[model samples]
Target: MELISDDAPKSLELENISRRFGNTYAVRELSLSIAPGEVICLVGHSGCGKTSLLRIIAGIDTADRGVIRIRGEYVAGPSRFVEPEMRNIGFVFQDYALFPHLTVEQNVLFGLRNLPRQDARTKAMAMIARVGLTHLTSRHPHMLSGGEQQRVALARALAPGTDILLMDEPFSNLDRGLREQMRDDTLSLLRSMGTTVVMVTHDPEEALSAGDRVVLMRAGEIVQQGSGYELFHSPNSRYAADFFTAFNKVQGIYRNGQIHTPIGAFPSARQLREESQAVAYIRPSDITVTTAQSGLSGRIVQRVLLGEIEQLAVKLDGLEEPICVRSLDHRPPDTGEVGISIRSEAVLTFPNP
Candidate 1:
């Protein structure tokens, strides 16, 4: 991948940006900046204000507070508000939102109207070929598959050579296999062209895979923002931890800066008064089912076969709920005592909220 030079100008910036509905703030005091060729993904569960923030940045919705700048120039703020069409930004909608009446080539040509007729036609054909849809150039939206329509929408958004691209669940409409393929293709083209991107996806895995930095949001606020590995391995809160991956939770009493769980005592990040409650969240992938005889023992109660791995439900000596563990073996252990070894780095301890 071609890296944008450090000297490349700031592509997009938002200062204390916010937007409000009738009685609620969709986006509250959000601030972010994008480099010339950076890709940032805003992700969270539904109604986390990610898409609302995206709309605010794209000028489709006005901000109730704060300033927006593009390439060091003020665009939206208290004193200035740029219209959507005036911002040199491209938007790819969730459904692609192509013109039903227009052919693939015509839909792409629609965005290049600023150029001359011949130039627009030339650019449209080039974009059509670029996305590998040259054979479907004359197909209408209804005649094309969901993935084909998405390529058309992408071509239309990018044909005009915008400085920034904003995608809202660009591959959500495609099937699983096609989604992965399209994502790789889209990122490759964007990285190659050095266009700045801020994409919104509700899928946690998608955000982790596609973004250079992942920003997880919750109720109009940023829960955490960092590289995929950083957020996945060292999340700041229980909510952030649970959002990224499934966890087996255990409650323990806080004492001497430690939380004692069923498995063992674990260190806590924050100091809590003695006798207070603390919680330990452990991911299933971090627990290894072993033959070693010295660790915590549990009886395998249930096993589920998932194509690449088997999910096991183990009942510990005194815990009420069975602890879930994932194994790559084709079959789970025979219904018998199984020793469990938990990785220290995979356990997250927090004082109870």
Candidate 2:
């Protein structure tokens, strides 16, 4: 891994990018700018165009309309298109696309065919060792574990010394425990190399934990984007709020710019018609269950222990469905009756549609 040049251009820039398939648009007038060495995670549901956007950036698919500039040079636009191989962009596919017959070193060396044989072999060995695979350099893909195969894919993609790399759900194939380890290890390696990365994933927690910036897309358009803290703490809409975590939506009425629900009155951030319907988004963790009668009266209908936290389904007096509350207290109240109080500051208010 080498330090990125200070004089290098912006890693990537997409202006009004769009792609269509028959009557449906996969990517719609999407625009984004990525800084050099930044790690960005593209997250959304199945048909949100996240993978489509990644393919366009890697030149695997052409944009129907827009301009793409990589490292300050035009790559794709209305009048020009660069071949995927000539774009100097590295891509790690979801399957860890390695040749079954090629050894670890040989797989990496394949990407450096443009260099002399000795030089390519030397650089390939260095990349293999950088990913901690020097001991398995002679092993083929079938002989390696999922994590090892992933490392080989990364080594091959990065051995070319390309500053920009695109990964599509690189860690999705591994099991839960191994997935976290591989994700952390992979990120550390990419950051050490000062590589500009655009990774696509459907997991919200992964997107929040892995990216320097998380781009949330919906229906082929960007719904919201910012740091993990920004998207989690200050979502702009109900859709954005629900994507990050589960929220207990409490319907309320808008009165004098405030949402008045059965539990409490919360400040509304969005302007709504007077007397129209409003909703409060509250996280299960944000609600506290107390034995004292200081808050709303609710009876615990069910309780389940989830390792570190205990989840309780509390049914309020008038609410149709029970609201869920998660607590980390070692001695959570027994399943029977409890008082529910929401953290006012953590409440997110939006208009009911």
Among all candidates shown, the one with the greatest lDDT: 2
Q: Encode model 1's per-residue lDDT on 60-114: one tens digit a residue.
A: 9889999999988899998999898889899999988899999998899999988
Q: Look at candidate 2 and give me any clashing residue pairs.
A: none
TM-score of 2: 0.96
lDDT scores for all predictions? Answer: 0.88, 0.91
| Best-performing candidate as measured by TM-score | 2
TM-scores, one per candidate: 0.95, 0.96
Off by over 4 Å in 1: 1-8, 269-275
Provide the lowest-lDDT 10-residue window in model 1. 1-10
Deviation of model 2 at 97, angstroms: 0.7
* Model 2 per-residue lDDT tens digits across residues 213-331: 99999989999998988999999888899999999999999999788998789887677889998898989999998875768889888888899998889999778999999989756
Clashing pairs in 1: none
Output the worst ten-in-a-row residue range by lDDT, candidate 2.
Answer: 1-10
